[model samples]
Target: MKILNKTMISVLCSSLLAAGPVRFINPTNSYAAESDVENNTGFNVENSTSTANTHNFSLVNPDTNIDVDIKYTDNTVTVTTITNGAEEHTFTYNQSNGFALLDGKIMNLEINEPDFVIDSEETLSPQISLFATPSDKPVFVSPGNISFSESVDSVGKVVAVITGAVVLAKMIGVTLPKKLIETKVQDALTLIGLGSAIALNTMSGSFTYGLYRTKDKFYTGYPGSVNSYQYKFRYQDMAVNASLLGKTMNINFSEVGSWWFQSKPM
Candidate 1:
């Protein structure tokens, strides 16, 4: 009876092993696959001559091999890629303000203080505030002190140069002195003095002072790890007739809409 009982137990265990072990058989073996590591969105690096140039970037390939279409509107960018050769590939997508977590080297690249409007009317010493790009968000990077706050030295340098020029010209006879009478010298001196005094008082420039356009390009990273990316979108109207209303922009197509194409030069 004991031998028969042992035999039954052994046979039952053998059946479970041949059928497939529920406890010991590993499912992870079937699940293993190549790690798909690729970026979907392209980084718009400006003047990044190399891969490491963080600001100067190239488009990163999307994971899984697929042909793609890229689109943009306002500050948003979108990409659509064909997933399969035939079901053929039909996919739709939309994205906005997409960004990737860059490697540490990218964040470490130098960024200067952005051009800011000094609001003297509201505050006693309204500091310089950095602005955004193709945007108005706060600057990603900025200097603690702006080149705006203490521009007296700059003013003085300019003024002194002018003064020296005048004095030197007076000595060199390139300029007409008051003694020259009815000469261009007297008028020039008068204008010079007036301009100098005003410039001196407004050393830091007037509240309205600043460069018209900001620098939009930057750099990042070492070679091989990061990519440099840059992108531009442009559209032109092709119409035989058009009209403009107050505070409104309108485009009227005569027979057909304008054509749009996108690509970078080799």
Candidate 2:
């Protein structure tokens, strides 16, 4: 397991370095319409009175502007973008496909299909869609819950102690009482079951939230957005202190980019 983890980390780090110089764009309050993002995600939304069939918006880093334009037709939706007023890029999709993108540098438009239906709120807003930060930085990972390997070690030690007690009891039963030995063995078995259950529950809900960052903004929540590629890493060594829960990761990446986006809130 240790060797496999090291190999995976090496491969991921190599991929990030080879991708290009890491960069981030400044994040601005400028918003992109929710309808444009949802249109690509397959949920039917009533057209905003703001625009009939076309939605035009811009998402900005402090310095760069990502212009987005979406066009809806009978069976398909087309998303177009001009980043910082540079060359245009486009993506087209229909219901079978799951997501749409404005540009790799901007937001990856998606809808929380299951949640949206439950909430029953469809007004155009970022509440249901994922936002993206502009950047070329390959990935950012947030420390998840504590690992349970130590707990397993504790259980093993307890079992060893119980086994030793049982052996000693059997060998010396001529002098020692039998009831005490039976009671101790039963108690040890009970503890083992309880400890195993606790460990399983703790790990069941654990997840590591990751983001890909650029020089200016930390792009998160854009799971399958444009330019988003899948990367994998193990969380064994990466840990978040309880004190730092819900806080922005303030590690290295501070040259021209700031980690204003925190793992907890977003």
Candidate 3:
């Protein structure tokens, strides 16, 4: 079942990519649309209606857009993301001349416990081991970059911590005479003060997300049905904290992408 879903979505997304761009509009607002971002995922809306509410409008593989309203009363979520994904997938044709592809759902999204973790110092890491249970292992070659990311401003952190520590030390009477403040002390202070920064610099995490559209040509499907494909929105996350520090802070993200197949075969 999961396999069928993945395969179907792959086909749908591919159709959007093969044909042309798609549009989504809430009708309540007559706002401008986003120009196709080169292979970028996610979207930033340009709304014209004064009464619009906040929502997330996103596009997935092959090319499909969904508007998720943040509130029930909010009636302004529309506009589409342009897409260009592959339109065809190759399949082997053997003695089985005609195999009808069965009908099945083409999508999946599961954000179980947490495959991601962020530390108190704002370092993020992804645990790749907790991706998906392989009901149907859709060949996960590699999606693009997902924004449930981990980034640190090392320099900014150092300066802030140093200043705070210096103030705290002065308050505690840990001050040495200026003449006796040797370069070695300065260096040692720099190192000890940056314990958190060092953890961040040494920390590593991984995550992947984006529009990945592909077609699965089933030799057994009905005549026109061959044009079908599925749009797949995939994610894999499982992150842990540095051994020195238990998981103190983290950002969790669950994602979705729409799948709608299109074809102009006569």
lDDT of 1 by residue, 1-266 (tens): 00011111111222211221121211221112323322222221121131211111121123222222323233222222222232111111111211211111111111111222322343212233335243222222111111111112221232222222222211111121212111111222232332211232222210010111112211111234222111111111111111111111121111111111111222
Q: Which stretches of candidate 2 lie over 4 Å from their true place?
A: 1-50, 95-266
Runs in model 3 lying further than 4 Å from the true structure: 1-200, 209-226, 229-251, 260-266
Query: CA lDDT, every prediction?
Result: 0.20, 0.27, 0.22
Which candidate, 1 or 3, has the higher TM-score? Answer: 3
Model 3 TM: 0.20
What would the per-residue lDDT of candidate 3 be over residues 130-204, giving only the tens digit for each residue? 343322233232333211112223422222222222211111112212211112112322333333124453222
| CA error at residue 18 for candidate 1, angstroms | 65
Per residue, candidate 2 scores C-alpha lDDT tens digits across 1-266 of 01112111111222212221222323222222212111221112221222545555443334444354555554335555454566465544333232222223222221110000111123111123235543444333332121111111222222222322222111101111222222332333332332311231111111122223322332344565642331222111211111111122211111121233322221
Error of 1 at 63 (Å): 14
* Cand. 3 Cα-lDDT: 0.22
Residue 86, model 2: Cα distance from true site in angstroms = 1.3
Candidate ordering by TM-score (highest first) = 2, 3, 1
Q: What is the Cα-based lDDT of residue 211 in candidate 1?
A: 18
